[model samples]
Target: MEKKKRFGVLLCADDSEYVKKKYGGYFQVFVGLLGEEGETWDLFRVVNGELPNDEDIDAYDGFVVTGSCSDAHGDDVWILDLVRLLRRLDSMRKKVLGICFGHQILSRALGGKTGRASKGWDIGVTCIHPSPSNKLLSSLCIPSHLLIIECHRDEVWEPPPHAEVLARSDRTGVEMFRYGEHMMGIQGHPEYTKDILVNLIDRLLRHKHIQTSQAEAAKASLKEKEPDREAWKRLCRSFLKGKSLS
Candidate 1:
């Protein structure tokens, strides 16, 4: 029998009661999107400073850095630790997929810059135009434009020197980017459903992170277009597993 692939999720966000009750936390959400039978998925709640041992790193087929409520540019202790860990992963050429804040942190780990989005907060379904110049896009058979759920105020201002911009949108310059074959960052939440976004929007409102008007507008956008979740799943799975695009 073939050996099972092992994956790790460096979960950055603390799960809210709603998410825990509904989806069993962000870890489960990601597993639902990327997990397959015969694969072992492990979770590391990095927000609380949980990480895999250094010697065990090689056991994982790939690692995923999840989105966080904290800013990627912040110099919090855990954030700094995460940066060091990411640097180690990069040096080893480990397959790493970063989402949202994860994307920004990965850029920072590679000596890139990250900050607030110049276009302000992008908090709804967005149409991402994958760069035609990227051979990987063509190989993955991804569509010209993919609709994805986005809820972020920060973005990667500059990717690493060797990185290629993979996708872009009107509001954000680096919607998606890749540094070599081992590292890729996506600004949207492919694992999220419309309902999860709705709940998050409510929480943001309760915490005054966004105004009611913005919340309403974001919710409205969701009704306007559905995310291309199936395509995203295939793209992520293939990239991490090294499956051919065909």
Candidate 2:
């Protein structure tokens, strides 16, 4: 039997596993796995605090940046170092994907800025509307509305140069964008499931990151906002099979 293709996943944080669980664990984290070309994906955890440079960064087939529970503007050296790594990756035109914190990192690394969210923490699913129509949207499994999990307090004030705004949401216009398409970043968590959204909402409410009323409002909004699962699945597959020229 032919082996699965190998993609490298530069797992970025302690909470990565927790986030992975939200998306069905290791099986659906969407991080690239690297191995003998035809082997399975091997998620390589890279703690940015340790600081890795180009030599340290070049070994992966692809790279994935995860959301950090830590703040991007805070004095976390790792976050700064990650900016360096992402800048290098961007220069090389590598297939890099950043979600949430990852997205902020990419933007900041490329001469952009990140700050607090305009609406605070968005704890449930949201509807990301495609910026305009294209092949990527052509394969979507649902309507232009994409229902995915969100939990962030910061956002990109301005996207990097050469970036394309592929999708946006009413909650946050930077819902989804492409760093050249093949290299993409999304503000929402498409990898997560409905149950995961519920579980995360539970966790956030328990910790007071969100209030009971907010959770209730978010749930009701999501019910009416998100696209179908099949549509989301189509979006994922489209991302996986990125443009040949991106």
Relative to the true structure, how large is the alpha-carbon lDDT of every model? 0.92, 0.64
Candidate 1 lDDT, tens digit per residue, 1-246? 877899999999999788899999989999999999989999999999999899999998899999999999999999999999999999998889999999999999999999999988899999999988776678767899999999999999999998989899989999999888898999999999999999999999999999999999999999999999998998899888875222
Report the number of the highest-lDDT candidate: 1
Which has the greatest TM-score? 1
Write down the TM-score of every candidate.
0.97, 0.78
Give the per-residue lDDT of model 2 (tens digit) for 1-246.
743444555556665346555554533455322122344455555554544445745544466666666666555666666777777777877777777877777777877667888878776667677754666665443466556778777887778788777777776767666766556777876555566567667777888888899889767766766635556555554564444423
- Say what the RMSD of model 1 is: 1.5
What's the lDDT for candidate 1? 0.92
Deviation (Å) of 54 in candidate 1: 0.6
